[model samples]
Target: MKPLSIITLDQISDALDSIDLLGEMRSAFIAYSSGRSVIPPVGELIIDEQPPGEVHIKYGYVRGGAHYVVKIASGFPRNQELGLPPGNGMMILFDVSNGSISSILLDEGQLTDVRTAAAGALASSVLGVPGARVGIIGTGVQARLQAVHHASALDRDDLMVWGRNLGKCSLLASDLEAHGLKVEIAESAEELAERCRTIVTCTASHTPLLTRPMIQPGTHVTAVGSDTPDKQELDPRILGSADLVVVDSLSQGLVRGEVARSIDAGTITPGRVVELGQILDGSNPGRSDPNHCTVADLTGVAVQDLFIAEAVARSLV
Candidate 1:
């Protein structure tokens, strides 16, 4: 039996610098939507204690791939108060041929964050206008990642951000400015929506923050905050009004995220949605008209974890 290798966060972070994360994420989505990967529904546990939190268990395998992956990640917003990062988790890799434990990646949620950011960037690049100023809603880790990723994707360094906490928004702006991005603090989400053609919402809000009336035509919105049924960032009507609606996983999107909310509200039909992979693979059109309103409801897919983990494991070897 081969020894199981355990990797740490530092090593994974270093390895990521050499990995083409955006390319890997793109391939992951294509594989998933093309029926080349075997991924089950996500399992989740919501903690309702004083500091609310949620844990997601995602696992899956790609056909004929070298390894399978099982990822466990958690998000506890109040952890920052205790001087700890809110995101934490690990990934377990197994030999595909023998079903034997191969490696354990103790990334502590960095992989999840990066893969998600990559997905958001890729979606925006495919569905959004080129060189459009980006707007981010949220002041947490994802907000920063999405800002930076979108900057790199669109080759634009100017961004507008809005959050409930002005202090946090200012802090995020400072961090992004250090990355060479021109940051503006929007007084409200409505203001942010009006200014930027490409907007990425990364909050954990249970209620809608971006309403239909706030969104303008020819805008592309990426909603990554709503991974659970009860969580929502965009009003259901936003999806109903969007000219193009995309999702990472159609099945998952139909049950969670903004798409689900719109469906439940009788605003949009499930058939109106298209998978992001379809756009990547040229099976579906993405924002053909500059005047079209587009929305991408990303719930996070397991194939992303599988591809990213496999890339990290191969890089380590």
Candidate 2:
């Protein structure tokens, strides 16, 4: 036993700097879509706010050639009541040769947060119009990651933020401005949606935060909030109108996604759905034109967990 190496979030960031983590993530996803990999089912246990249910766990494995990653994430909102962070997680990488544990990365949810944003950025880079002003719904952890990740990907400098809390949005706007980028806090989601063609949502809302009327032609929206069956962040109409709809994992989304519910309701269909991996591998079209409306429904994936694990393992300690 190597005593289960512990890699912290700060160390993970340093590791990312020394390698092309984003490129690795992109390649992993593309390989997944190309049918060269297998991602097992994600098991989730939800905690209702009413009773504040038990802590939930989601674990999975992604096998890509001689490498494999085992990922586990646990969330307990009630941990906040106990004065602790609500979410915590770690990943274990296996060499696949002799069944030896290669590395254990304690990402502290940073891998999930960052990889989710990076995937969104990759989707935006492939689907969004160049130099598009970005719109963000919710100014939480995921929102901050999205802002930085997408900015890095698309060379976007203008950001528009909208949250239910004006003060928080204003704070986020000021923070981005301090980074030498232009930021605006919108009064409403509709206002933000109307201004920017590229929208990313990362709120913990169960209801729809964005509506069809708010969207404009050529807009690219990535819904990263709905990882469970009961969680939703965008209007069903948005899915109905999107010219190109891509998902991180079709099986995961169809079982636990807002878009999946719409597909089940006949508002959207499986035929209209595309996988990001397919698009990345050139097996499917990404963006046909600059004016096409695109939507990437991200429920997260096991492959991403593996991707981040590889990134952390190769990082200099």
Model 2 residue runs over 4 Å out of place are: 1-4, 48-64, 78-83
Residue range 84-193, candidate 1, lDDT tens digits: 99999999999989989999999999999999999999999999988788999999999999999999988888899999999999999999999899999999999999
Query: Across residues 160-185, which tens digit of lDDT does each residue of candidate 2 receive?
Result: 89998787688888887887778888
For candidate 2, the C-alpha RMSD (Å) to the true structure equals 2.4
RMSD of each candidate? 1.0, 2.4
What value does the lDDT take at residue 263 in candidate 2?
79
Worst 10 residues of 1 by lDDT: 60-69
